[model samples]
Target chain A: MIEIDNLSKKFGDLTAVDSISMNINEGEVFGFLGPNGAGKTTTVRMLCTLISKTSGNARISGYNIGDKDDSLKIRKIIGLVPDNVGLSEHLSAYDNLEFFARVHDLSKTERKERIQYFLEMLGLWDKRNVSVGTFSKGMKQKLAIARALIHDPQVLFLDEPTANLDPEAAKTVRDFILDLKKQKKTIFLNTHNLDEAQRICDRIGILNTKLVSIGTPKDLEDAVRVRKTVIELEQVTDSVLKSVQKLSLPNLDVEGNTITFDTIDSGSKNWPIVEAIVHAGGHVNIVKVVGSTLEDVYLKLVGENQ
Target chain B: MKLSKAWLVAARDFKIFKHQKNMLYGLVIFPVIISIIPSAILNYAVNRDPPLPAAGIPPILDAFSIFLIIGSAFVPLGIAGYTIVGEKVEKSLEPLLAGPLTDGEILLGKTISAVLPALIAMYTGGVIFMVGTDAVSYPSLNYYYFPNWTIAVILFLGMPAATIMSVEFGVIVSSRVNDVRSATNFGALMFFPFLIIYILGQTKLITLDTETMAKISVILLVIDVVLFFISTALFKREEILTKWK
Candidate 1:
């Protein structure tokens, strides 16, 4: 549903979004993961036509993002939930949805039915008449999502929809998004929460100014070349940590008697570590090698980009 | 531009204005205050000992009537400021810009929101001012000095032009300013030129008569057109989403 090729945006000397290219299919939930200043929001803004791209081409549902007439058509077919929610505090929740619905030229009946349907579905029907200023952050965030979907656009671009919400509230939003996914809505989700991305996204792109990597959760985890090994010592002395540090093993993490490090070659690396621990008078308890996770892949890719 | 989309924007703003007590009060009260204070001064002078000369009343009535136009220009600064900057501060403007509407349509909608209430208030105030001045000055002048060409010219021609200029100026100023107070204060600068003309007319440096006022109205209309283009250029979706502070 969304096609982007070499998209870039520069603010004078600073390039907010570098040459990034990817495709998102219809009825797919594509998640964009990145750190602050990583161009995730910039990419979303350029695609949504809220801001112009400095270079490159993008199309939404076969409509060009750069063309004037097609820009409107692209906008008509897509809905955006901005990072800040951007709801009118003075207006009631229902009024907020109705205003956007009217902007999209929805009929009176369509507006009423959609507003009621979304509000009720999102558990905001009880607060429909209340001013948004009085709503909780979760409620306001839900309302923003409803406002975006009021016209029933084909594709939805969500920028950090669950950023600052409480865990429960975030879960509510996640569940609602899952519901949208079930309905086969094409969703482009930009998020900072790694777990959310892993749980919700069909395919995730780890971005840092450039497209560092893109794959499904398992595929990304499998992309990491090195496995991690944890040596559970019966009693870790300061000398054991010092001995392991002397070797300068990658990603060495120690918690009490347990030490974990990235292992590229298990037989060669583990024997040396066991010798170091035994020489330091620490008894071997448990040694295990574990596969990498999405966090590990994300950190490795984003860290490499940085 | 699709005017229906513009109207949707204006209609939403009107609904929001119902909750803004300050904007509503400012909209209603400025014209009322300008209308009454001038009439009060005229009434006080007419009933005084010498009863203020009959010939002196018409020029004074014309001078007082010009306040309607000045008030017309000043009244919408608040509404215009609130409508544009309020959205900016709330960050709600992004979704609107992200919608299918064009830059021209949204700006036109805001212009309508600012112009409609201002014209209504000023026109209503003009009515009250003309009736009050006629009631008080009639005994001395032996005629209703109002309902004349000069005041009509000011009301129908000069006032609308002034209002449109103020609104467009507000939109331009709002692009650079983040808050409503700053927007309104800076937006008020557009009327300074009109105020200077008002001062010139009061000092007899320029005539406040029908022909001169009509000429000034045309000039104001021209300025309005020029500012409209500039304001639209400044109101770009990209500029607004990216650069507006």
Candidate 2:
């Protein structure tokens, strides 16, 4: 539901967001992953119409972001959760939601219903009356999420939504994101957490070479064979050594206590490593097959680009 | 529909003011306090029989005029400073920039908030001072302090210009600075010349007669027009978001 074409934002000599291009389909959770200062937030801001694109264009829901008529229309269609949450800490959760609802021009009944529903869903109903200044980091974050969804925009742009949250709060946000996907809302998430992106995103794009790779997790694994296989021995004895030495898997590399091999069969071919160790009189403790992760792809793309 | 947004913004500002005790006092009660000091000083000097100024309006009228200029000067400075810098401190500027409202709308909303309360407090102080001083003075001194067209122009053109200038400068200053205090202090620096003119004119140390007021008003009108355009030009949303340092 979004189209970006050669989107580049320059502040004098410094190019915050280099020439980047990507398309996000409706109902797809597209993860825009990058390290700090990697232009992820800038890209989101440009798409959200908060900042202008220095060159090129971005269209949201088929409306050009550069066009004023389409910009307002686009604004109504998308909801943005900024990186900092940027919430008014002194205002109560309910008040904050009410303010944004009014800004979004929701009818009173629609606003009330949505606020109540989202607040309850995010487990912030009890704290709705209290000021956000008094809330913990997690509570404030939940309120920000509720605020973003108050108007129920068709597309949601989330920036570091789970940045500083505890594990439970992070999981709560992730689960809510998954729930959004279930409801078929197009979500554009910018995050440093590769795992969260991999878990929640339908297609992930690492922002190294601007539009490095865009596809499902398995598609990424298939395209980039950066997988890992580890065979754990019950005892690091000489038999364990002989067994590992005997199996000459293609593209294999081994170091102390760790052996990594490249196999065309991805994650399902870990049984051979276990079988080899066991047949050579070595006690196999556990075997794990680590597939190519978004992190690995991210590192490889960014590293290669550098 | 736009009024609704403006009111929403005003309410949001008021909610912020509720938390900012010092700022609430700065905008509302502190102007009154500053007014009271002069009132108290005049009361002390007069000691039940006030001295009439030889050149122009009565001392009470002079005091009210001084109050007007002071109110116009300080009220907008304090309110506008808090309005712009408060948003910066609270990190609300990004949302405002991201929202549907334009820079003019946001600036007008803040200017009105500052101007409205200032006019109210100034008028209230004038009424209270006139009544209180009349009880202690001659019958000839009792007079109406209705803002003339000249004063109206000052209130209309001057208050808004001062507010706009202050807020624009505050926004720029706050954008560069970290917190409200430094921005407010930096913003307050812009009001010095006006304060000097008001002080000198009010004390009769250098009379800003009707002719001077007109000239000054005309000059301010031109300056206001220029500053209005300049402020708008300076208000580049992308520039701000990108070069916020």
Candidate 3:
């Protein structure tokens, strides 16, 4: 579990993260969404104790990030895959994992078993001996994830874990993340891939140098939900448009026999509009509510901040 | 500063160095070439008709030993220079820093890795040079001149002090520089002091006796300690992660 309270970071005049606060429960997959320079990486670094936060505080698994005494304890429980994969290219995949394993102070037998398990699970067992430079971008990312998990840390911080990977490779990483979630791993994922976040995150936080919104996907979507109804017709007539207008819909517009309008109450207003259109002798093809998506919510939130 | 973790880092660096041909050349081949060439020249000179005047050993052999010791000190320059900056460029520093190891531990690990091979090569080259000089000067001097107290002092005290100083300097340079080339070029400057010492001893401007050797060793040890503290102070994870370009 992680607790962030008034966490802020400033580099001289520029504020990277501004008093953002949130709590991630145990086993929760929390997705941190942000644009470039939105303090996503900065937040993760502060949490991992890689960099010092300019103000405020954070704690991982009850260990304060600002306390040097708790640094090793915090580090022992967390793993980070930074924006860059950061693998030792000259070393083999196994060697890379071994180095991390040793740094975590895992015993030889434990390190061997964990490395074998993670590598095999990530489908990297066969390429364990090959230098990481020879691996594809996806393979390196997977290896990085494996390295992060080699010690079985309690919380995993991944920054753009799938950024630059092919679709298949990204899917593999996403699947692996899902598997981690199943195992009750607390994952703090910083990603631009909205679909992946929507698919796997138990809760999501949208940030643009500040916490814009944090909730379930549906909750975030509803916060920025646009109440509009779209109606399709087999044929449109002037009478149909006039009849729909008479229903006092907000922002009424007609395009190529399709009518779109905003309504305060889409659930109740849609039926009357459909009946009015039917009364005007227009054949009804479809009537549907336009619900907001995570992308829409993200763009709306980010766009407003800009 | 968990030494086990530090050792892990050192062992990993050593493993990587094993596969690096350029580092191999610097560590093994370079010292051998620099040592053997001078030893061969001395051997050739001593075998001449007149047989260069010898009391115990030729003065040129002592000069060659200093040269070889200094040469061995340079071996770790490239290695230490590449340690921090190279890992930063390769993007490997992040995960390593994110680990439980302290900055001191990581620096210690890298220093040990770079220093060990360099000291080994220096001693190995010293032995080879000694054997070659003794073999060639045998007809004239009739005895082995190496393994003297002065040479022992140079090997055990002076070389380690110099190597540690170079490694500390390299770590400092590597932390500040963005690239290995810049780090290496800057770290190579560490050699100048040792070079000056060698030159002074060779010219007889400074004696190569135990007293002079002790003084130089003490000076180098002090420098190494100061530089080590300076480097450790500068090796902050925040500065490296944020300030480095």
Candidate 4:
């Protein structure tokens, strides 16, 4: 579990992370979401004790990050995967893991077994002997994950784990996260990928200058009250646009050729607008009922904070 | 676990050195080249018309000692320069910092690790030059090439002090500077004092006799102790990593 209270990290006039407070329970996959420079990485850095907080406090696995006595315990309990994959590029995948295994104090047998298992699990067994410099970006990421998990840490702090991965590689990382969840490992994931957050995270926190919102995806959507109704017409004529606009959606915006409207009524659907567009000599090309995505809520919250 | 982890980092650096042996020339070969320069000068002096005063230990040792002093500057610049900056370059520093090791521990590990190989190589070269010079030029080996307490003081006290000072300065430079090369070049400035001392000793302008060497060793050892604590204190995790310049 992780607890942060009014934690603020400032670099001169720039406040990287402002008085942000949140709690992540054990076994929860908490997604820390934000845009670039939105303080997601800074918060994780503070939690991992890589950078000290200018104000307030954070406790990881019941050990206060600011406390010297509990520093080692906190480090032992957390596995961190930074946004950039930093490995001993000259060392083979196996050697890198072996080295970290020793640092983590795993016995020879345990180290070998865990290294083999994680390498095989990450599909890196065959390439174990090759220097990491020879591996692709995805392979390096997988290796980084394996290194992080080598110590069997209680909490995993991942900063943009799959930022630049191909879809397949991203899915592999996702599957690995799910596997960690099965092992009851708590994950503190910092990511800007809203869809990934929605899919993999149990709860999410939107961070701008600070912790702006924290909830499940649905809870965030509800809090922001974003509706998902697809409106399609044969021709997006003036009359059709006027009629669609008159649908009285509270928060509405035009995105390209499509008009997305956020309505207050939970039961109100896009059918009436479709009918109105058709009556106005426009055909509904695409119509589907959807819900507010994590992105919608994230942008809204970030906008409000700004 | 901490000690082992420190060694692990050290070993990893060594392995990486082996892989990219060429890049290590600045550290590994520079010391040898520095030693060889003095050896070459001594070789010429022995063969010259007016022979240099006190050939073997006096002249060659002076050159070798100066080599060490200058080489000490480069060792820290090489090791400490690359320690943090290399991580930043390869983007591995964050994860390393995330480990349980404190800044002092990490620096200690890296400092000892980087210093050992360079120092060992230089010491071997120095000994070989001493023996080689004794064999070729000396009428007898006993008096000219004896292993005196001065030699011990130079190796144990003088060398380590210079090494630590270089590493400390290098770390401070690396923290503030963005580029590793720039940090290293800037850090190399620490060698100027040692170079000046070496030149003065060589020209007989400053007497670097056995007694003077011992005195300098003690003085340098005290300086090293002070600098070590200062470097550790200035290396505040909150200050360098989180704070802005």
Candidate 5:
């Protein structure tokens, strides 16, 4: 688990992360989303103990982040996959993993088992002997992921883990993350892909140099407050149209036996309108709610702050 | 500090060195070339028709021997100069820094890796030069000028100290600089002090006696200590991660 309070970082006149605070629970996948220069990486760096915070405090696995003595303890429990893959190009994939494994002081047996397990799981076992410089971008990214997991840290920080991968490779990484979650590993994922975040993250934090919003995907979508009810009808008779118009829903439009109307209260208003249309002798094909997606909520939240 | 962690780092660096053709050439071949040049010159001079004066043995041989020892310093300068900055340029520093290893451990590990090969190469060069000089000068002098106290001090005490000092200087420069070329250029400056010592000895201002060698070794050991502390102080992890750009 990770906790932060009023954590901020400043570079002279520029504040890269401005007094943002959040807690990540054990075994929860937390997605950190933001645009360019949005302090996502800065926050992750502070938590990883890679950089000192200019102000505020944080703790990882119950160790204080600001305390110098606790830095080693914190590092022992956390792993980071930075935006750059950060693999030693000339070293073999196995050599690279072996070096980090030694740094963490893993036993010989543990190191061997963990290296082979991660390599196979990430689909990199065959290429373990090959130098990392010859690996493709997707393979390199996977190796970085494996490197981060080499020590089996309590928390894993992945910055843009799937940035350069093909769709299939991206799915592989996503599935691997989901597997990590199943095994009760806490993950702090900083990503630009909203769909990936929505699919995997139990909770999402939207940041723009500050904490704009943090909640589950559904919770965020429900918070957007823009709703539309779409009704598909088999026939649009004049009587049914008049009966539906009697409800006087706002922003109503009809085209080709389909009607769409804006409603701030879709939950209550949709059923009533559906009943009125069916009673008025119009065959109802389908009725659905629209206009609230994670993308929509993200754009609205980020756009409003901007 | 954690000795095992430091040793692991050193081992990794050595593995990388084995794969780097340029670094291998600098470590093994460069010192050989530096030693051969002076040894060849000494051989030609001693075997000349009249044979150079036997009195010239101490100064000429001493100067070339000092040159051979000083040449070892450059091996570390060329290789260790790139250790930190090269990792930064390659984007490998983050993963290393993210580990539990402290700054001192990382620095000491790199110093060991750099100094080990340099000392080996220097000792190898010293042996080759001694054999070549002894073979050529045997008839005239009928005595070996090497394996003496001064050369012993230079090889055992002075060379290691200079190599360590050079390595620490390179790490210091590598920590602050943004590129390998600049760090190496700054590391090249480490040779000037040894150059000064060689010049003083050649000018007869400082004789190549055991007493003088003792004093020089003490001075180099002192410098080595001072540079080690200063480099350790300058190697701040936050500055390297944030400010180097």
Candidate 6:
């Protein structure tokens, strides 16, 4: 449903978003994982037609982002929940949704039904009349989501939807997004919360100015292959340290009497290191090989790119 | 531009304005005070011990009418400030800009939102000021002095042009600043040109006649058109989301 080709955005000498390309299919939850100033928001802005891309091109539902006529058409099919939520403080939650509903030219009856449906679904129906200024951060975030969905757009762009919410609030937003995923919505989610990204996204892309890696969560984890073996010895001697260093494993570290290093294939590679320690007159207290996680892959990719 | 989309934006701002105590008070109080203060002063002057000379009333009345135009110019600054800068501070423009509306449509909507209320309030106060001025000056001058061509030109033409200028000024000022108070303060500078015209009118350097007021109206309209372009440029989503700080 979304096609981007060689997209890059620059502000004078600084490039906010660099050349990157990806396609998001219908009903696919694509998570953009990046740190601060990683151009996640910039990419979303370009796709949502809120900002212009300095170079390259993008299209949503076959409507060009660079074309004025097509930009409006693209906007009609997309709903965005920015990182800030950006809810009107003075307007009531109900009025906020109603105004957006009317902006899309929904009839009065359709407006009423959709507003109530989204509100009830988001668990905000009881507080519809309350001023948004008085709402909690999670409540305001939920209301923003409702406002974006008031017109029932086919594609949704969410930038850091659960950045600052409490655990329960974040879970609520994640659950709501998962429900949308079930409804076959094309969702482009930008987030730094690894767990949230892993839980909600079907496919994930790690970005740092440029698109570093893109794949399923399990696929990304499998690519990193960062099973680490950590051994606690009774005493550390130069011979024992030399014995492990002779292996030249990746990411080697020594903290007090413990030795740690990345194992290529922990099933076959971990035993030699344990035997090496024993031969070097080091008593092994405990030996454990830990599997890699999404964070490991994320940090490895982001750290490598940085 | 889709006017329905514009109206939706305006209606939303208007609904929120209804809930704002400061905006509501500014709407009612400025008009009432502008209408009453001049009428009271004129009445007190006419009832003075010397029974202020009837012959001198014409210039004073002509000059006093400019206050209505000035008052109308000043009124929209607060509303414009709140509507434009309030959104910037709250960061709510992203969602609105993310919709199908164009930049021109959003700017037009905001302009209408600021202009409609100021016109209604100022025009209502204009009527009251006319009636009250007539009540005080009719006996002194031996005739109803209002509803004349000059006052009509000032009210219908000059007032709208000035109000539009104020709103456009608010837009330009809003882009520079992140808060409403700062926007309004900078917007207060917009009235200096109107104040200069009023002072010139009082000094008889420029007559406050129909022809002069009409010319002023056209000049202000030209400025409004120019400022409208600048405001539209500044209000673009890219400039706002990136350049505005």
Computed on alpha carbons, the lDDT of every model, listed in order, comes to 0.89, 0.71, 0.86, 0.76, 0.85, 0.90
Q: Which portions of model 5 miss their true places by more than 4 Å?
A: A228-263, A267-289, B196-216
Candidate 2 regions with alpha-carbon error over 4 angstroms: A229-258, A264-290, B1-3, B48-64, B133-137, B140-161, B202-205
CAPRI-wise, candidate 5 is medium
Q: Of 3 and 6, which scores higher on DockQ? A: 6
Residue A229 deviation, candidate 1, in Å? 1.0
Candidate with top lDDT is 6
Q: What is the DockQ of the complex in model 5?
A: 0.65
Q: Can you list the residue pairs that collide in candidate 5? A: none
* Cα error of candidate 2 at position B83, Å: 2.7
CAPRI grade of model 6: high
- The residue-by-residue lDDT of candidate 3 on A1-306, one tens digit each, is 799999999999999999999999999999999898999999999999999988999999899999999998999999999989999999999999998998887989999999999888877899889899998888888889989999889999999998888999898888889999999999999998899999999999999999999999989988887767888999889889889877778888889978888756556757877988899999999988888789989999999997
Can you list each candidate's DockQ?
0.88, 0.58, 0.78, 0.64, 0.65, 0.87
In model 2, residue pairs whose N, Cα or C atoms come closer than 3 Å (at least 3 residues apart or on different chains), thus clashing, are: A1-A24
Model 2 Cα lDDT, one tens digit per residue, A107-185: 9999899989988887778888888888877767767777877888878889999998899888877888888889999
Report how far residue A224 has shifted in candidate 2, in Å.
1.3
Candidate 5 lDDT, A35-140, residue by residue in tens: 9899998898888888889999999988999999999999998899988889988889999999999899999999999999988886778989888999888778
Query: Candidate 2 chain B: worst 10 consecutive residues by lDDT?
Result: B52-61
Residue B131 lDDT in candidate 3: 78
Per-residue lDDT tens digits for candidate 4, residues B1-245, read 36666777777777777775544676667766754565576677766777665534465565566566567657657667666677667877667777766666677677766677767766776576556555544642345553556666677777777777777777667777777788888987887777787788778788766677777777777877787777777666655555413
Arranged by TM-score, best first? 6, 1, 3, 4, 5, 2
Provide the clashing-pair count of each candidate structure. Answer: 0, 1, 0, 1, 0, 0
Rank the candidate models, highest lDDT first: 6, 1, 3, 5, 4, 2
- Candidate 3 per-residue lDDT over residues B1-245, each given as its tens digit: 77877888899998888777877888887668765887678766767787667863556666666665576567888889777777988999999999998988888898899998998888888888777777777777777777787678778888898899888888778767888788878977777877888789777898767678778878888988899888888788997888776
**Chain A TM per prediction:** 0.88, 0.85, 0.95, 0.87, 0.86, 0.92
Cα error, residue B107 of model 4, in Å, equals: 1.3
Better of 1 and 2 by lDDT: 1
